[model samples]
Target chain A: MTDNATRDIEELIGMMARLPGLGPRSARRAVLHLIKKRALLMMPLAEAMQQVAATARECLACGNIGTSDICDICSSEKRATGEICVVEDVADLWAMERGASFRGRYHVLGGTLSALDAIGPEELRIPKLLDRVRAEGVTEVILALNATVDGQTTAHYIAEQLEGTGVSVTSLAQGVPIGGELDYLDDGTITAALKARKRF
Target chain B: MTDNATRDIEELIGMMARLPGLGPRSARRAVLHLIKKRALLMMPLAEAMQQVAATARECLACGNIGTSDICDICSSEKRATGEICVVEDVADLWAMERGASFRGRYHVLGGTLSALDAIGPEELRIPKLLDRVRAEGVTEVILALNATVDGQTTAHYIAEQLEGTGVSVTSLAQGVPIGGELDYLDDGTITAALKARKRF
Candidate 1:
C-alpha cells in the first residue's frame, strides 16, 4: 500500500495494541476485521466511541463515571440510604450495579494504595470519601474492594480513618464463590469458607 | 447512573462487543479501560478510526484494502514481477507482509467457497483474479490459502479455472512447521510432512 494509508492503519493498530487484552498480533487482526466490515461494524463503533468521548465524565461526588457531574446514583433520592460502598475503581462500581443487589451509593477510590507505586490516601479520593461520610450522614461504609493485598490494606486504612466518625464499616463476605467446588477452590478461599461457615 | 449516560456507555460497549475475537465480558473491560484513559487512549483511538474509515477502501484490481482505488502494490513498478499470491482474506495478506518473504503483489479472495454457506466463485473475487492474471501478464499464481477443507477446495477450483490461461499454478508447501514436534503433531500433518520431505 501507499505509505500514507499504510502509516495511518499502522498507527491505529499500534493504538489498539495498548488496550488491556489486545496484543500487537490481535490488534492487527481486529483492524483488518474492522476494515472488512467497515460499513456495518467499524463506522458504528467509531461513532459510539466519539459519542462516549464527548459525553462521559467522572462523577465529582463519588468518582463514578457518568455524563453529569454528580452521577446518577449520587443524585438519585432513593439511593440516599446513608450507606456508601467503597470500591477500588469504577469498573467495580459498574459490576456492583450490574448485580442490582446494592441500593446504596458508591465511593470509587480510583486505585488501591500502592507504596511501590508511591500512591497514598491523598492521591486517591480518600479525603472526598471521608467528606461524603460526614456531610451526607452516611451510617455505613461498605468495603467492596478486591481481595488483593493492596485492596485489603487500603480497606483497612479507610476503616481506621472512619473509626472516630461513628460510621460502621464492613466488607463483602469472603468464602467459596457460588458454584465453586472444594476440589477446585484455592487454599485461601477454602480456609476463608471454613472460617466463615454458616447454617443453611 | 442516569439512563442517558448509562445508555450511551452501554451502547458503546455493545458496539465494541461486535469486534472480532472480543466477547461481551472483554468488551466491557476494554470499554472501562478506554474510559479510564479517555484523554490518552480513547479519544485518539476514535480519531484514528475516523481517519481510517474516511480513507481506507478496497483496491479495485486485487481486492486488497488500501486508501485508494488501486493499492500501492498494484501501482508499484517494482511489484509487477509477473507473480500473484492468492489468499483467502486481508488478514492472510497482512501475515505474508509481516513475513517479508514474497516480493510480488497479492490477490485477496475475501473468503473460501463453502457449499454449506452457499459461497461460490461469484461470491468471492475469483473472477477478478482471472481478469488480473490475463490483463497483468501474471505468470505464476501461488495459492497460499489455509490447509482447511474449504481452503483446499477453493484452491483446487481456482486452479481448475486457470487451467487454460497458460499461467503456472502452484500451492504453498506443506511440511512439519518450524518448532513443531513430531510427538505433538497430528497424523495428517505427520503424513504430509513425511510425504513432502526434501533433501537434508
Candidate 2:
C-alpha cells in the first residue's frame, strides 16, 4: 500500500478505538474483520451510520433521539398515556422500550445533576420535563434514573419540582434483581428487598 | 423512534455486533457512544471504513491486505533484504511489524493447511512465495507460523518444499515468554523452554 492508504487504515483503527467498549488491540482486530468482510459488513455499516447521522434528531417535546423533529413516542397518540418515564440518556430509554412493559412515553434528562461539574437543572431537560407534564396532562412522572448518588439527587430534585403539579411522582422499586443470588446480593439491595418484601 | 428509524439503529447495532470483539450489548454501547459523538467519531469512522473498503486489496505477490496490487512492504526497497518472514495471516504480519525487529519483507499465507477442511498448498500463497524466493534471491525463509497444530504442520510443509532451493529455513525460538512466570507455564511450553535452554 501507499503511505496515504496505510494512513487511512491506521486512521480507521484509531477511530474505532475511541468507541466506548473497544481499545487499540480490539480496534485493529475489528478493522481487519471489517476489511475481510468489506462488501458484506463494512460498506453496509458505513452507509447505515451515514444514514442515521444525516436523519437522526432529538424530539421536540422530549429529549428522545429519533429521525424526526418529534420522536415516535411523543408523536404516537397511543403513547400519550398520561404518564412519562424519565431517564438519564437515550440508551436508558431504549432499554425501557426493549422491556415492552411500560406503555407510556419517555423524557430523557440527557444527564444527571453534578455540583462539581457545574451541571444543574438548566443543563439537563428538567424544565422541558416539567413543561411536558403540564402540557400533556401527565398524571404520573416516573423517575427511572440510576441508583447512584447523583442520579438519586437529580430524581429527588425533579420530584420536589413536580410536588405541586398534581402529578404523582414515583420511582422504580429497588430490590435484588430477578434471578439474583441472595448470597451475592449487596447490603443495600438486600435491605431494600427485605424492607419492601411483598405478601403472598 | 419510528419503526423505520428504530430498525436503522438496530441494523447498525447488529452489524457492529458481528465484529470480532463486540457482542450485542457492547455494540449497543458502541453505537450509543458513536451517536453521542456523531461529528467527532461516528461520521469519521464511517468515512474511514468506506475509504478502506473501497481501496483495500490483497497484495498479488504476498497476499497482504493493502490498498494497491502490491503491499507497502512488498514494494519497499529497504524491505527487499533477501529474507522473507512467513506469517499465517495479515494480522500476524502486522504483529511482526509492530515489534519492529524484522527488517525484511513478509509473505502472508492467508491461512494454514488443514486436511479436514481440504485446504492445500494452492489454497494459500505458497506458489507465490516459491516464485518470490527464486526471483528475489531470498537467503532465508523464516517461518513465523503459530505454535498451533495446523500452523506447525503448514510450516513444516513449507520448509520441506524449500529443501533444495538453496535457502535456509528456520522457525522462531520456543521459550518462556517475556514477563511469563515459570509457575504459570503450561507443560508443553515448559518442556520446550527446557529443551531449548541457552547460556546466559
Candidate 3:
C-alpha cells in the first residue's frame, strides 16, 4: 500500500506504546477506539489535551501542578495549619487529597534523595520546601516520604536540617514497608499513617 | 486564592472523569502522575497527541481510521488475495493481523446490523464490502463477524446477498460463542476459530 494515510495512526501507536502499561498492540487498539469514538471521546480528549498542554504549569511555590505560580493549597489561608505534609511527588499529594481530611498545605519534594541514581536534595525541591516552611511559618513538618531506604534517608536528612528551626519534625507511621510508596498504598494505610504519626 | 487555578484544575478533573474506566479519583491521580512525569512521559505524549489531533482521519474505503481516503489494506495489490475477511469493526481486523495468518484484504463493517439499536446495513460498511467483493474478484467471502446475535444476523444477510455471485461463503467457526467478541477472546480462541473452518 502507498504509505500516506497510515502515518498518523502509526505515529499515534508508536507514542502510545511508550505509555506505562500499554504495548504496541494495545496502543493500536486504543488508537482505533479513539478514532471510532472521535466525535464523543476523541475530539473532547484532543481538545482537553491541547488546553492542558498550553495552560499547565507547575506551582512555582510548592511544586504542585496548576496553571499558576502558587497553588490553591499554598495560598489558601484555611489550609495553613502550621503543618506542611511532604511527599515524594505530585501523585502522592493527589492521593492525600483523596482522603479529604488533610487540611494542611503540601510540599511536593519531586523525588527522593538517591545517591545510587546520583539524585541529590538539590535535584529535588528540598531547598524550595525548606524555604516554604520558613516563610510560611510552618510549625510541624510532616515527612510523608515513601518507606523506601532512600525515602527514609531523605527524611532523616531533612529532620537534621530543621533541627534548630523550632519545628516539630515527624514522619508517617510504619504501615508502609521498607520500599513501599504512598501511591501503591490504599487510602486506609494513608489515613492510619496520618493518625498514628510519630516523631522522627 | 483566585478562582482561575481552582477552576482550571476542576475543569481538568471533570474532563478526566469522563474517560472510560476512570473516575474522578483516578483522574486526579493520573493528572498528578502526568505532571510529575512531565519531562519523561507527559511532554512527549502531549506532542504526539497534538500531532494526532491535527492529522487523524477515517479511511474512506474500509472505515478503518487513517489520514487518507483509502487505507493501506485497500490500496495495496498484495493484500487483494481474491478473498475478503469481513469483521464487525477495525478492532477485529487488528486482532486478525496480530495472528499474522490472514494475508487477504479486510473489510471493516464498522458495526453489527443492530435492529434494537436501529442500526441497518447502510449504517455499517456493508454496501462498500459488497462493492469490494465484486470489484476485487473475490472468490471467498469469510464472515469474521463477532458471535453476537446481531453479528450472526448481519453475516446471514451478507451470505444471502452474495448467493448469486458464485463466491464461497464461510465463517470463522463455532469456537466463538453466541455473544463473544473476537477482540476480548485470546489468540488461542482466534486460532481455533480460524482452524475449525465451517461453511456459513
Candidate 4:
C-alpha cells in the first residue's frame, strides 16, 4: 500500500481496536472485510455512522439516547404506568425493552455512584429521577441496577432519597439466573435463590 | 425515542449486525457505546470511514487496495527482488506484509479457483500473474494460499501453468504451527511435518 493509504487504514484499525469487544487482530480482519465488501458493507456502515453521528442525541427527559429530545417510552401516553424502571445505562434500558414485559418508562442514570471515580448522585440522574417521581405522580421506582457494590450503593442512595415521596422503591430479585447450572452458581446467588425459593 | 428516531437507531444496529464478527446483541452494545462516546470515538470513526470510503482504491498494477494507481510495494525500487508473493486475497497479502520478512512485491489473485463455485483461472488474476512473471523478469513466485482443498487445487494449477516459464513456483510449508502442541495437531499436519522434517 502507499504511505498515505496505509496510514489511513492503520488509523481506522487503531480506532476499531479501541471499540469494546474488538482487538488489533480482529480490527485488522474487520478492516479487510470492510475494504473487500466496501460497496455492500463499508459504504452503508459509513453512511449509517455519519447519520447516527449527526442525529443521535440523549433524550432530555429520561437520558435515553435517541434521535429526539424525548425518548419514545417517556413520551408515550400508554407507558405512563406511574412506575419508573431505573437503570445504570442505556444498554440496560434497551435490554428491558427487548424483554417486552415492562409497560412503564425508564430513567437512565448514565452510571452508578462511584466513590473511586469521584462520581456522586449529582454525576448521575438521581436528582432528576427524584423530581420526576414527585412531579409525575409516580407510585413505584424499580431499581434494576447490577449486583455490583457500586450498583447496590446507588440503589440504596436512591431508595433513601425517595423514602417519604409516597413512592414504593424496589429492586430486582437476586437469585440463580434462569438456565444457569447450580454448579456454576456463586455461593451468594445460591443462597439468595434458596431463600427466595418458590413452591412448585 | 420517537418513531423516526427509533427507526434510525434500529437501522444503524441492523447494519452493524451484518459485520463479519458482530451479532445483533454485540452490535447493539457497540451502538450504545458509540452513542455514549460520540465525541471521543463515534465522530472520529465516522470521519475516518468517510475518508477511507472516498479515497481508498485498488492498485491497478497488482490489484492491491491503496489510495493510488500503483501500490507502494509494486512501485518501490527496493522491492525489486525478482520474487512475487501470490495470495488469494488482499487480506492474505496484508498478513504477509505484517510478517515483515519478505522484501518482494505481491500479486493479489482476488480469489482462488473453486469449481464448486464455477470460479476459474480467468476469474482470478492467474493470466495477469503469468504476464507479470515474463514481463517483470520474475525468478520466483510464492503461492501462499490457504490450506483448504480449493487453495491446494489453485496452487497446483498455478504451478502447472508456470511449468516451463523459467520461474520457480513454491508454496508455504504445511506442518505443526509455532507453539502448537503435537497432541492438538491433526493427523494430516503430523504426517506433513514428519515428511518435511528438517535438521534442527
**Model 3 quality (TM-score):** 0.73
Candidate with better lDDT, 1 vs 3: 1
Where model 4 places Cα greater than 4 Å from the true spot, the runs are A115-118, A147-150, A173-194, B174-191
Cα lDDT of model 3 by residue, B136-166, tens digit: 7899999998877888899999999898989
Residue-by-residue lDDT tens digits, candidate 1, B1-200? 55577898898888878777788888888998999888899999998998898889999988888888989888998999999999999889988988988999899999999999999999999999999998999999999999999999999999999999899999999988899899999999999988988899
For model 4, residues A74-101, the per-residue Cα lDDT tens digits are 8899999999999999989988888889
Candidate 3 off by > 4 Å: A146-153, A172-200, B1-6, B13-30, B36-55, B95-103, B113-123, B134-136, B146-164, B172-200
Judged by DockQ, which candidate is best? 1
TM-score of chain A of each: 0.98, 0.96, 0.84, 0.96
State the lDDT of candidate 4 residue by residue for B18-106, as single tens digits.
Answer: 76778888888888888788889988998887788778888887889898898888989999999999999888988898899999989
Q: Tell me how far the alpha carbon of residue A60 in candidate 4 is from the true structure, in angstroms, after superposition.
A: 2.6
Is candidate 1 or 4 superior in TM-score?
1
The 10 consecutive residues of candidate 4 chain A with the worst lDDT sum are A65-74
Docking class of 3: acceptable
DockQ of each: 0.70, 0.69, 0.29, 0.55
Candidate 3 at residue B111, lDDT?
Answer: 86
Model 4 chain B: ten consecutive residues of lowest lDDT: B1-10
Interface Cα RMSD for candidate 4? 1.6
Kindly report the docking quality category of candidate 4: medium
The single-chain TM-score for chain B of candidate 2 is: 0.94
